[model samples]
Every structure is written in C-alpha cells, then in structure tokens.
Target: MNQLQSLKKITTVVADTGDIKFIQKYQPKDATTNPTLILQAINLSCYQNLIISAIKYAKLKGGNHQKKIVNASEKISVLIGSEILKYIPGKISTEVDARLSFNKEECIKKANSIIKMYEEEGINRSKILIKLAATWECIAAAKELKKNNINCNLTLLFSFAQARACAEAKVFLISPFVGRIYDWYKSKNPNEIYSVKKDPGVLSVRKIYKYYKENNYKTIIMGASFRRIEQILALAGCDYLTISPVLLKELENSLGVVDQILNNEKKYYKNNQSLSESEFRWHHNQDAMAVEKLSEGIRKFAKDQENLERILSKNF
Candidate 1:
C-alpha cells in the first residue's frame, strides 16, 4: 500500500476543504470546512452558482443586501458541508463564526442554529460536527452542546490547557494546529530553521497526543493546518488529521512506506499521568511556545474571518 493507505490503517484521515469535488479522490473518512475555505470556494467559477443561489434565496427571505449576504454565507456553508457528508461516511465539521469566539451564549446559540439548519436539510445531526475556536467560552459552549448529543470539533488549539479542558468536558474532538506553530517558531528563529521531525508544530501535536493517551482522555485529537507532508507523516498515529486536498493528492501519488509512529500502549508504559485543571493551566502558562502560538492562532483566525465578511459584503 502507498503511504496514504498505510496511514489510514492507524489514523482517520479527514479532508480540510470546502471543495466537495476532491473529497472522493482522497477518500478521507471525514471533512472539515471553515469560513476561509468556504470563501475560497465561493470565489471559484465552478462554485459561483452555489453562492448566487444562496444570495437569491436570502434576498427572497426579505433582508438588506448585507444581511442577505450573511444569511447566504451561512447557507453556502451548510450546503457545502451537506455535500461533503454525501461522500464520506464519517462526520463533517462546519465552523461557527470566529467573531463569536468570545461570546459563550452567542456561540452556543449559533452552533445549535447551524446544526438545526443541517437537520432541516435532511442531514443527520450525528454525522455533522460543529467546529468552534478553543476559547474558554467556546469550550464551555461545547460542554453544553455535548450534553445535547451534539458533537463538536474544537479548532485553534495550541496549548495543553485547552486540550485538557476539552477532554475534561468530554468533547467529541479537538483540532490542534500544526502549521501555525511552525510559523511562529520560524519567525522567532529565522537563522536556524528546524527540520520536519524537530519542527515545533510536529512536537506540539506529539506532546498533546501523549498527554491525551496517558490520561485515557476520550476526546479525539485531530491535528489540523499542516504546511507540509513531513508534518503529516510525523503524526502518523494521531487519532485523526484534517489534511488539505493538495497534500492529499501528493500523498496519493507518492510511493513510500508509512508506519505507525504513536501507540497508546507505549505511551501508557512511559510515565502516564492525568492532570488537574490547575496543573494543566500551570503547565500551559509556563510553555512560552504554546502561549504565544495559541494567541497568534486566535488573532489570525479572527482577522481571516473579518476579511471574509468584507469580501462577502462587497460581492453579495
């Protein structure tokens, strides 16, 4: 088997794009979409109709152009997510607005609204995962959602505290960012860039994985935002990973052996321990890398979300 096939045996591969066309080619178990990916798709000629139709439907619902656009964007996201679910038997993670990252109640309300929209379109709620930023408020929102049996995929996770909190809340999954971590390290030490194995992003995910396994946390860790194939290869045995279609295609054509690099059994034998909230918080606060990277990830996503709204306002 090729590396992609081999990796699948150990980890659940997920496509991290809004483009439904390429999903079947990669045969990922799950798919994830954010505002940026949906915005990118809407700009394409092939996807222009999806946007136009959403806009028309929104206008018919009686709103100003800006309101119509916002409604349309939400509709477009739901449509893309639903389409993706048709290809994969697993869940499709659709994100809430990053702008609401700080608002716990608003985030929870929006997440439930999105899930309801999906259910209205005949999509099973069980097959749809609501994606949220890993803010304290967002984590709290996810905790409540979990009680309602609504699965969540926590994005922008960079610190162990975030992971511990999510795991403690018994969330469905957490997406620990990989590429953004590397970006931070490279910015700080331009003179001595690290290789893929030693890349800060790779290490961050590994550390989070080890902690999760050691504690017997049931919340799945899904590594996200990879910049290279090497980063993905390094995380061969993560619970799941959301890789872009570009990388997915590359892995498909490459001829290489992939082996399971992480094992729960091994980690359990090596100083396994659980962490209380205070311990987890102290450890995360002490790690300058996680502290800086988590802040950076939140800021970047917030900016991207603003940019997306700007684009929608101008066009819609």
Candidate 2:
C-alpha cells in the first residue's frame, strides 16, 4: 500500500487546507483552517471566483446586525469552511482570530460568534470545531464554550504546559505542533541532521500522547505543522494528524513499508497530573522554545489575518 493508504489503517488523516479543490482530491476524514490557510486559499487562481462570490454574498447581507457584511473577514472564513465541509465527511475546525488568544472573555465571545456564523449557514454546531490558540486564557474560554455544548480545537500548542491545561479544561481536541517545534531547534543547530526517530518535534508529541493515554485524558491529540513526510509517518498513530496538501500528495504517491510507530499499550504510572493556573504560567515561561514559538505563531497568524482583511476590503 502507498503511505497514505497505510496511514488510514492506523490513523485518522485530516486535510489541513482551505483550498476546496485540493481538499476534494485528498478526501481526508476532517478538514481544518486557520486565518493563514484561508488567506492563501482565497488568493489561489482556482479559488478566486469562489472568493469573489463569497464577497458578493457578504456584501448583500450588509446590515446593522451581527450578520453584517462589514464582518467579511470572518464571514469569508465561514464561507470557505462551509465549502470545504461539503468535501469532507467529518468535522471542520474554524479558528478564532489569533488576536483574541489571550482574552478569555473575548475569545469566548469570538468563538460563539464564529459558531453563530456557521450555524447561520445552516451548518450544524456539531460539524464545527471552534479553534482557539492553546493559550491559558483561550483554554479557559474553551472550557466555558464546552459548557454550552461548543466543541473547541485548542491550537498553536507547543509545550506540555499548554497541552496539560487544554486537557484539564476537557476541551475536545488539541493540536500540538510538530514542525514549528522542530524548526526552532533546527535554527539553533542547522548543521545537525535529525532523523524521525530522534526528531525533537516528534519526541515532544510522543511525550504528550503517552501522558494523555496513560492518564486517560479525553482531549484528542491532533498533531499538526509537519515539516516533512518523515515527520508525519513518525507520528503514524496519533489520534489525528492534520496534514498539509503538499505532504498529503506525497503520501498518496509514495509506496512504502509504513508501520505503526505509536501505540497506547504502554501504561505510565508517574503521578497523573494537571497544571494549576500559576503552574501553567511558570512552566510555559520556563520553556524558552515553546515561549518563543507560541508567541511567533500567534503574531504570524494575526498578521496574515490583517492581510486577508485588507484584500477583502479593497476588492469587495
């Protein structure tokens, strides 16, 4: 079997793209989008007409109410999300604005707003995972949203502290980044070549997965931000791996002897634990690489969001 076919036998593969064309081609179990992916998809030549149509629909709905077209940046995100949903069989993760990552109440409000937009399109709330960065406040917001039956995908997660807090909140899922974590380490030691077996990013995720499985935490570990096919295959049996189209295509074409690298058979007895708010802050602060990368991830997404808004405003 090809790597992609082999992967499906062990893991739930998710397409990490907003481009409908590629999404249809991969037909992953689920689909996810951030502001950055939405921005890139909307600008693609094949998706331009779709973007224009969504803008037109957004303008037509212009009003003084919550559904106003002036909110096209978010509205367009939903439009893209809805289109992708048509191609996938499972949930779609639509992210909250990265700017709201630190504001629990604002993140709560924005998450509901994004959900409301999806619901307005007649999409059921169950079909969407309101994605928020795995900041302490955002995790808190997700906890609150979960009370209201809103599922959340805690994203931009880099450290065990972030992952632990999200699990404590009983959030539906957490996307612990593998590539971004690897990138930070590589930049500091460019001459060192790392294999999938010893890759820092791969190891970081395995630690979390073992912890979660050992402790029986319910939060789904959806590994994200893969740098290479080896990284993806290294995490072969994560709960879910949201893969970019480039890597997805590579997996689809390559014939390989893929094996299940992760298993839940090992039980760890080290004190099953959770981080309190202060402990969470302290642990996150102590991890220099996580601190740097998490902040950079939020900033980059926020900037990409602004760029999307500018394009929407100028053209629409």
lDDT of 1 by residue, 1-316 (tens): 6778888889999999877678878888999988778768777666777667666766777677767766777777887787778889899999888888889899989888888778878997899889898877888899999888899999988877788778877899999989988888888899976897789888988988887787677889999989989899999999998999888888888887887887786445333344564676687788787788767666766676667667667665
Badly placed stretches (over 4 Å) of model 1 are 63-66, 266-285, 314-316
Report the C-alpha lDDT of model 2 over 236-268, residue by residue, as the tens digit.
Answer: 999999999999999999998678888987575
Regions of candidate 2 where Cα sits further than 4 Å from its true position: 45-70, 266-273
User: Using TM-score as the measure, which candidate wins?
Assistant: 2
TM-score to native of every candidate shown:
0.89, 0.93
lDDT of each: 0.82, 0.88
- Pairs that clash in candidate 2: none
